[model samples]
Target: MQPTILITGATGGIGIALARLLKDHAQLVLLGRNPQKLTSLQTEFPEARTEALPLTDAQAVQALIETLPALDAVVHCAGEVVLSSIQDSQLEDWESMYQSNVLTALVLTQQALPQLRASRGKVVFVNSGAGLRASPGWGGYAASKFALKALADALRQEEPLISVTTVYPGRTATDMQKQVRDMEHAEYQPEKYVRAEDVAQAIKTVLDMQRPSVIEELSIRPG
Candidate 1:
């Protein structure tokens, strides 16, 4: 049987790119917040299962996980980026970033632990370079991603049965990046950033590694 893989943020650029690559290699379970996008992706890949629900809704996420069969891997690509300096950032912005970037991943991974352990599954977190270092206008976003990095590290240590890989990619050409650029009042240049498909390829490499030798962290930067 093909390995069953779950991808969060299925509607986003990197997530969608990953889906297109993995469709033939695995049985996909695509989860995203947008119903229309999920339906669109489902139509494109009829063999894959699709779920449209807010990742922050813990109970709903748990329920969804309970219905799935043995899972072979989970690729966490859901995240949010808000640009605000420490003095300018509001509590609401911090909360929103935390909920989207860290809390959702925590809740979903906790819910999927059983299935993952049973299959010795791999967990790939699509992190950002912001998680590594904070910039002038990225305080809240960086904090959330830092928390996510911590979670990934803790999970790697605690869950020996499941391999965990955290990927930190530099600026990517995605809608989210466009939003970030708008917030920064910088020019939106897609060509200068990394391609979402390239990041997806890096994730594919992580999942394809040989047993007993796992990549704990992967950092990708545009050339």
Candidate 2:
């Protein structure tokens, strides 16, 4: 049987790229918020199951977890980014980023732990370079990503059998990166940024890693 992998943020650039890359060979459960986009993608990847909902709701996540009979991996790419100096950052933006970046992963992973343990699965967190270091206007988004790193680190130590990998991709050419560029008043040059498919390919490498070893963390910057 093909390995079953559940990927969040399925409608996003990197998410869609990864789905296309894996759909032919893997069983995919793609979770995202945009119903129309999810429906559209379902048509393209007819074999993949699509779920449309907010990941912040623990109850909804719990229900989803119960429906999965078997799962081999989970790739968390669902997250939000906000740009602001420490002095100008809004309380709500910080909270929203935390909920989107950290809490969603927590709820989804917590509910799926049983299946993960049973399968000795892999957990991949799609983090950002901001997670490693903060810039002047990146405090809020950076903090949330940093918290996500902490979550990945703890999961690794606690679930030794289940491989946990955190992938930090630098400024991928996604809509989110365009938004960041707009906020920064810089020209949005998609060619100047890393390619989304490259990030997706890197993730495929992580999942292909075998027993007796695991990729703990990977960081990619534009070449």
Candidate that scores best on lDDT:
2
What is the overall TM-score of model 1 with all chains considered together? Answer: 0.98
Clashing pairs counted in every model: 0, 0
Instruction: Give per-residue CA lDDT, model 1, range 1-223, as digits (tens).
Output: 9999999998888999999999999999998888888889989989999998777778998888888877999999998887887988899999998999998999899989999999999999999999999989888999999999999999999999999999999999999999989998999899999999999999999988878999999999989
Segments in model 1 whose C-alpha atoms lie over 4 Å from true places? none
All models, RMSD in angstroms = 0.9, 0.8
Candidate 2 error regions (>4 Å) = none
Superposed by TM-score, candidate 1 places the C-alpha of residue 203 at a distance from the truth, in angstroms, of 0.3
lDDT of 2 at 14: 87
**Candidate 2 residue pairs that clash:** none
